[model samples]
Target: MIELQMYINGEWKESSNHEKRPIVNPANGEVIAYAPEGTIKDAREAIDVARKTFDEGIWSDLPAVERASYLFKIAGKIEENQEELTRLETLDNGKTLREAGYDILDAAACFRYYAGLITKPDGQTYHVADPMQAMVVREPIGVCGLIVPWNYPLLMSVWKIAPALAAGNTIVFKPSEITPVTPKKLFEIMDEVGIPKGVANMVFGAGPVVGHEIAASSKVDMVSFTGGTKTGKHIMKMAADTMKKVSLELGGKSPNIIFADSDLETSVDYALFGIYSGAGQVCSAGSRILVEESVYDEFVNQFVERANEIKVGPGNDPDSEMGPLVSQQHLEKVLKYIEIGQQEGAKIAAGGNRIVSNGLETGYFVEPTVFVDVQQDMRIVQEEIFGPVVVIQKFKDEEEAIKLANDTDYGLAGAVFTNDGAKALRVIKKLRAGITWINAYHPTYNEAPWGGYKQSGIGRSLGTFGLEEFQEIKQININLQVEPIGWFANKNE
Candidate 1:
């Protein structure tokens, strides 16, 4: 078994209390690793060191070009360990190795993309009233606190870390308690890239302790979190004590609307890819599918057939299309949602039970579930199951579809499938979501802006918006005239 340690101040260290937790493989409930259960004192030390590093200007004061070079090197390090990291992620997070490979590639791309953009001059100069000029410049926001989720693990960590480092800020990060193995690998790469002491620190423990302390740290200038809505809200409340900048990317019960005019075969394929990808653990999975009344029956039949064909088993299996959930707790949660769906009178059109066969009896496996005749108000449709479960509801027209899609409290992501380009565009405009796709689902890029409206999240990540999240804006005013008109007692010089 691998032994994991927290990376802080450029060193791998055990918790002060020597507390540790076993890292279990959800595929077979094996103890694959043991990670430090860092405490509040450990979290404070990481934050303090990051604060000192930022204040010392070791990282935050570097020239943009110099910082970009470091980021480029870090990206290269990630690329070199791509294969190893992919397997480790599959072993730790229970995602298919194929999916893990895609995420690592994207993580590398994110670092490179941010590295290329960080050097470009930010802020603008404007000519104002006579003999005066105004300039708005962006600067790093000092120390940052980053909390990553268990679902995407390393990818989410990279999403926060790349931009923060590229923007010239030091950070103290906290990985999810359940899946800390891949993050340890990430710190190993960060060390290989020679990131300075305290510039990038991490702690592994429970959210209420390590995560909360990071958010509540006065030394941290900003907090960026990716997780559930409840935790995001609590982070907001805690960060408010210090008035720190907060950027959150939270949960989603996204809607995937399919019209009758859409390509039938293509729509069915996208729907399956939408929810079943990542075992439906993706935050932006289109869990609530709304199909037109004319083609509801046909679409449901083919979609069920496709879901049934999915090979669910250990992630390492080359033929396995869907892997086990991340843990036994999460598996139980998904199974409970399936029961709730049936209790609400929704018909199960596809698999909806625990998979206990083919040497998978001990694994946390739930078959991909599809529900039909689901009402918009049903808990199964409204709540985020975050599993391989999907709910299909019929819509009479575009108007009803829009209403149903916008019904949820979440406005993170949604997709529309139709042949008419104009109709697709129209539907896209009406959908109350931050990210919308015409015929595709869950295709996110490092070059584009991502986040959500309403409860789904606050602020945006990726693209220029993501870089700006770790930045603080300052406006500078210059007076060309040697003498200034006196507006107050000491106005004239």
Candidate 2:
């Protein structure tokens, strides 16, 4: 098994407690690696290193173009190691190899996207009245504390890392203790690329210790977190003490509305892809599907038929269309939600049990589950299962569809599929989500902003907005006419 250590101050070091935790492969329940179980002390040290690095202007003082150059190099390195990284991500995250490959490509592209964005003319000059000149420039927000979730380990880390580094901020990053392998590999790449000392530090441990320290620390100027809503709320409270800038991308019970006018086959296919991809571990998983009532029965039948056909197996299996959940704990959580749906009087229209055949008993595999006849008030309909468990609701008309779709606490993402372009536009516009698609689901671009309108998130990521999250804006006002006119004294004289 591979042994991983924390990256701090440009060196790989053991945790202050000298304790290591086993990193398990969810596919086969094997201990694939060991990661340092960092303590609050180690977290404080990493934060201090990042703070000193930023305060010393070692990285933050670099020219914007110079910072872009480093990001470009890092992107090149990621592409160079794409295959290996993909394999490790699959092994660590328990996602299909194909999905992991996509993440690797996207991670590289994210770095390149930010690299190009940083060199562009970002400051704005205002046309002020007469002898006054005004402009706004963006600067790095000192040391950043970045916490990423376990689902998209490498890509999510890159989503925060690339932009933060591109904006010239040193960071103390914390990847989920559950899936630390690929992120550890990423830190190795940073070391090889010669990232300046203390510019980017990584700590590995439970969220309560390392994550808490990072969010609550006074030295960290900003905290960017992507995880469950509960944890995001906790981080907000923690950052509130120091008044640190906080950006959160939290949970979503996003909706995918399929109308009768849409291509039935394509809508069914995408509906399956929406929730089943990544085993529905995605934060923006379209777990809530609202169907036009006229076509609801037919769509439900076809969806169940296809969802049953999905090949569930280990990530290494080439034929596996969907892999296991990230861990046994998560598997249990998904199964528990499935049980809750049944207990809440929702009918199971598709697979709802664990996959134990074909020598997959040891792996954390659950069948793609679908529940029908679910009410908007049901817990399964409202809560984010974060697994391959979806609830399909029926709505009578366009108005009802929109109402059902927006009935959740989350407003992260939504989509409408219909042949009527005008109707699609109208419905999509009404979605209270940050990301909406007319006839698509789960396709996101690095060039566009990604976040939610409500509790789904507080700030956007992955575009120009993503870079600005780590930056502080300053307005500069200058008086071109320097001569001062005395109003009161001259009048008295």
lDDT of 1 at 305: 90
Q: Residue 213 CA error for candidate 2 (Å)? A: 0.7
Model 2: residues with Cα > 4 Å off, grouped in runs: 485-493
Per-residue lDDT of model 1, residues 283-325, tens digit only: 9999999999999999999999989999998888878899999
lDDT of 2: 0.93
Clash number by candidate, in order? 0, 0
Question: Model 2, 293-314: lDDT tens per residue?
Answer: 8999999999999999999999
Which 10-residue window of candidate 2 scores lowest in summed lDDT?
484-493
Q: All candidates' lDDT scores?
A: 0.92, 0.93
Which residue pairs clash in candidate 2?
none
lDDT of 1: 0.92
Write down the TM-score for model 1: 0.98
